[model samples]
Target: MQFSIAFPLAALTLLISTITAQAPGSQCGGIGWPGIMFCNPGSVCSKINDCEGLHGSLADQM
Candidate 1:
């Protein structure tokens, strides 16, 4: 059915978009870092030693 094909295609598109859009382990909040920061779903930005960054497993990793 058209629904079946559409569902999988939509899911694939979403996954690819998520991967390309988010920078899971990249730097987030810290001194001398002037930029907006964000983490992927199911995680939060936290301090990692001297610089703040995202510290959580990504969806693809799980």
Candidate 2:
């Protein structure tokens, strides 16, 4: 019984660590833009476009 519990716990820990390590976003899904604030999901703006006209500016601070 103890062996079974330990094995499952170890597996769960490994899985959690793996997921956290691979998680996205350093800030706001990694979409922080300069002079802009947020990026829209499912928008068709390329990086060459400078992420402008694709997202709204930050409120009260832009």
Candidate 3:
């Protein structure tokens, strides 16, 4: 019984990690003109260089 629980838990952890391992650009964040912008959750615009108020212009435009 313990082995069965451990197996499923391990499998679920692996699956979750795998799904989240994809590029951050794959999810919604911001726009970077030439490329997709990505930021951590709850991150401020100031944290990203090409994000609106951060750099004035998109990275691709610069």
Candidate 4:
């Protein structure tokens, strides 16, 4: 069987943008991509930039 990375990449990119875009204090970040999530107005979101160190997969992040 053959697999295409483009699809997964695209999905990740989409999730990174959509999920991260929150209106309030939402649990954003930790998608194994590093520096993707964000916080809303008067909210705080901790950004973890060392996902590779934990040695995990994309789903594992969630």
Tell me the TM-score of each prediction against the true structure: 0.40, 0.34, 0.35, 0.30
- Candidate 3 segments whose C-alpha is farther than 4 A from its true place: 22-62
lDDT of 2 at 1: 92
Question: Is 1 or 4 the stronger prediction by lDDT?
Answer: 1
Model 2, residue pairs in steric clash:
none
Residue lDDT tens for model 4, 1-62: 13488788888876676565654433355655454344433445545463422222334346
Best by lDDT: 1
Model 4: weakest 10-residue lDDT segment is 50-59
Cα lDDT tens digits for candidate 3, 1-62: 99989999998876675454424324333355443343333332233543433322234343
Score residue 56 of candidate 2 by CA lDDT. Answer: 23
lDDT of 2 by residue, 1-62 (tens): 99989999998876665444321222222234443233333222223243323322234123
Error of 2 at 61 (Å): 44
**Residue 26 miss distance in model 1 (angstroms):** 0.8
In order of listing, the candidates' clash counts read 0, 0, 0, 0
Ordered list by lDDT, greatest first: 1, 4, 3, 2
Q: Per-residue lDDT for 29 in model 2?
A: 27
Off by over 4 Å in 2: 22-62
Expressed as tens digits, the lDDT of each residue in 1-62 for candidate 1 is 99999999999876775664436566667777675454555655667766665545545345
